[model samples]
Target: MAKARILIVDDSPTEMYKLTAMLEKSGYEVLKAHDGAGGVALARQEKPDAVLMDIVMPGLNGFQATRQLSKDQETAGIPVIIVTTKDQETDKVWGTRQGARDYLTKPVDEDTLLKTLALVLRG
Candidate 1:
């Protein structure tokens, strides 16, 4: 079977690079977008296996993007995993409500990220 394709939506170049490197090393095909609108567009066009969303951004934000993806019939089947710096309980709850399969605080642990990805892919 082919490796999963993952879409990473983050405005920060550093965070994007880190996540891209990690996912690539773990054998996932990584697609990237700099902001929420771009991410939503890419996700709709590519229909990637999963999405790694970052919360804070200029316009649209991760929460709004995730909600859009989840609600859209074209991308609703794709799972979203929010990878943000926000470590609040409410954030986690809200992310799930927005249709995230899981939430992880950044800087993310490689092991946890891989494990979570694997589980999400399986389910």
Candidate 2:
């Protein structure tokens, strides 16, 4: 079987590179977008298996982008996992309300990320 493809949307280059390295090392295909708008476009066009989104972007935050992706018929089935520095309960609640399948905080733990990916993909 072909490996799963993941779209990562983050404004931080360091975070993007780190996540890309982790996903690539785990044998997943990684697609990148620097902002939510580009990420939304890529998600709609590419229809990747899943997306890892960052909440605090310049325009079209992760919540809005995830909402768009989830509500859109073409991309609704794609799961979005929020990866951001916002670790408050409200942030997570709002993220879920926006249609995020899962949420992870910044400086993401390798094991937690992998496990969450497995669980989300399995669903």
Candidate 3:
């Protein structure tokens, strides 16, 4: 099978590096964006199999970016999973409402992350 292409959108360089390392080690192709607008652009251009999006960003923010990607015909099928510090139920609900396929909080556990990715990217 071809390696899954995942787009990770987060402002923290450290977090991006960590996640990239982990996913790459697991044999996945990873693309990254340091902010929401960049994330959206990459999503459209790259057509990644999945997106790991951060909620808090400079200009567009993950929720808005995810919404745009989900609504756009070119990128609407990409599965977006919100990964952020927002642990509130409302936040998860809102993220889902904005078109995130799944929600995860910060300090993400590797097992769960991989499991969610597997479930979402199975094709």
Top model number, TM-score: 2
Give the clashing pairs for model 3.
none
**Which segments of candidate 1 are over 4 A away from where they belong?**
none
| Candidate 3, run of 10 with poorest lDDT | 114-123
**Residues 5-52, model 2: lDDT tens digits:** 999999999999999999999999999999999999999999999999
TM-scores, all models, native as reference: 0.98, 0.99, 0.97
lDDT of 1 by residue, 1-33 (tens): 988999999999999999999999989999999
After superposition, candidate 2 runs with Cα above 4 Å error: none
Ranking, lDDT, top scorer first: 2, 1, 3
Query: Candidate 2: TM-score?
Result: 0.99
Off by over 4 Å in 3: none
RMSD of every candidate to native, in Å, equals 0.6, 0.5, 0.8
